[model samples]
Target: MTDKTVLTERNGRIATLRLNRPAAMNALTADMLSLLGDELEAIAGDKGISVVVLTGEGRAFTAGVDLKALRDSGQDLTEGNVGDALNGAARWVQQLIERMPQCVIAKVNGFCFTGGVELMLACDIIIAAEEAKFGDTHAMIGLRPTWGMTQRLGRKVGMQRARELSFTARTITGVEAAAYGLAMEAVPLAQLDSRVDELAQAIAKNSPGSIAAYKDLYRKSENAGLDAGLAYEYETKYEIADVRERMAEILKRLGG
Candidate 1:
């Protein structure tokens, strides 16, 4: 249930994954990334698990990659190997989360910076604490994001806003993030967990097959042209064989 840096707890069909290094603000180290990947892989294979809520144990969801570890590694970025390794891990983790059949929700409790923002971009939904702060400080750190930030962030917010945030390395509060369309909602810190649970439970109550299909469909169609997206949706309709039965069930539940 708990690794040194990552803790996983399950309640019914929902699994909560916490970045456990609270003292260091859950700054990610290479070992932590590997452990997180392992945890996600295990959860992905478990059919009984339908939702995952990713959060941090302490004051920050994550302060991004552990700069101390990177500095100590002493790998020259000009040599490309070090940058490649780091970028590769980030990309793999983000893509894995995006592609998993189970829905992933980011419960942003506090600071979410640099690579942490990239992680949030990959989730299906993000519910942030009112006190949470978000930023992309890659520029300030003399680095650029290699994860999907450049692409996904723009899609989440406007291109102009994404440019302002990344270029300026400015931080935004959770309220601002919601206003900018980055998070689904922002709640008081006290209500963050309960709000996330309410949303996750609502999704969990739906048909698992339909949920999985819908998640996949949305991801696939989001990048396509409207006509193309419509065509894809039309084609995917056949993939869900129980639509009529589901509709009937809905009617029955409505006391029809």
Candidate 2:
């Protein structure tokens, strides 16, 4: 599990997972995908970790799926679901990233295209270097997405923008991605790490119980009507272990 294709590092309450095929532009090989999933799975259950940042070791966040590697393995990329073709690595990893309890951030540093876009879309927050590249090339190869690309992309950006990018197979900078609502923000590459670290630290300071509930509630609200969503939000029962202590601390600070 400690192979170079994927690497995991921990700092206090935060965990960082890096894709490590720099030579191949950190292409998403089967092993890389599976290992990434394993790292996420472990973090999901780790009470110590409140956040995870996903990025690449070298130039790219990831160049996307390694089609050549899949072809060499006797898989038909043009066939049914690409996930199925790759023996479920694509679908599994992305799903794990999205479903995991920890808040996940995709720290897009460089080139991110096709399946790379799919992978990042699974994260709760995406921030990138302004110079980073992003595109959806599924149309270029006449392939449909099976890794939640179509669904998540449309949700991240609007359906119109998603279709435009997918159909054109055109590349856009991280700044453009932010404008398109694909990434929440983009900063100079030099500042990306510090910016992401700041964000992760802020999130880590929050009550884990409340944050987990928020994640679940927001996801569920997506499918419900306004009335139902509001009702769910109020009626939902989520206990914050630190609620009493936090309130007392605030009162003391205010000299109550």
Candidate 3:
């Protein structure tokens, strides 16, 4: 685990990234962040890979940032040191996940706390297992969030619920996460990989050109008002060349 804090695998058009520090419950270290950032950078440039699934190697998705690592590095959550310790490389990894050309899914197999939750939220989609725990324990640890937790959490689960979770520092089951809008769905642990694969395969089979366009359009729309988003959608040039071929293939099954 020291040598490989993150592992990568590719199957056709889908890539899977697994956090490899099971003994530490896949805790986040600066080294792990560097490795993950490198992996994501490579994946982002791959036109053949359209989907990525991120999960843990063992029981916990992650117990959040490696506090021991931070302490050993002579950093702590004292006053303003929290953000300083986590910014640079760590922040880059979060941005990489958000801006990647391909869709990223967080497969929460087990305990997900604080920074782990932040990392999980960075993914475009979240499919959690029913037994997994989702918690924002920053308050309990006396450390403020340096990751996008303050911003992204509210967006995912609405501001009020987000406030409650962060304020209370409580944990929730994956089923509750879906109902609260943090996860797309919560399924049995045994079905998590299969379900993710099912969706990943379905998405991978679609036209890559259109997929790229959709990703670009969706990313752009996130910051724009509705009218502006719609205007862009209507006026911008859509250069996908396989629409006719796709339509023809679909129409062949229409009994027309």
The best candidate by TM-score is 2
Candidate 2 Cα outliers beyond 4 Å, as residue runs: 1-3, 78-80, 83-87
For model 2, residues 1-256, the per-residue Cα lDDT tens digits are 3447888899999999999888889988777788888888999999899999999988999998887786677765556445564448878887787677789999999999998998898888999999999999878877777777778888888999988998899999999999999999999999999999999999999888777888878876865888999999999898778888888989999999
* CA lDDT, every model vs. true structure: 0.87, 0.87, 0.88
Model 3: per-residue Cα lDDT over 1-55, one tens digit each = 2558899999999999999999999999877888899999999999889999999
TM-score of 2: 0.93
Q: Write the per-residue lDDT of candidate 1 for residues 38-127, one digit (tens) a residue.
A: 899999888788899999998999999888888888868654233665777677778779888889999999999988998899999999
Off by over 4 Å in 3: 80-85, 238-241, 251-256
User: Where is model 1 more than 4 Å wrong at Cα?
Assistant: 1-3, 78-82, 237-248, 254-256
Q: Distance from true position, residue 10, model 1, in Å?
A: 0.9
lDDT over C-alpha atoms for residue 225 of model 1: 86
Candidate 2 accuracy as lDDT: 0.87
Residue pairs with backbone overlap in model 3: none
Q: Single out the weakest 10-residue window by summed lDDT for candidate 1.
A: 77-86
**Candidate 2 vs candidate 3: which has greater TM-score?**
2
Q: Which order, best to worst by lDDT?
A: 3, 1, 2
User: In lDDT terms, which candidate is top?
Assistant: 3
Instruction: Report RMSD for candidate 2.
Output: 1.9
Native-to-model Cα distance after best TM-score fit, residue 25 in candidate 1, in Å: 1.0
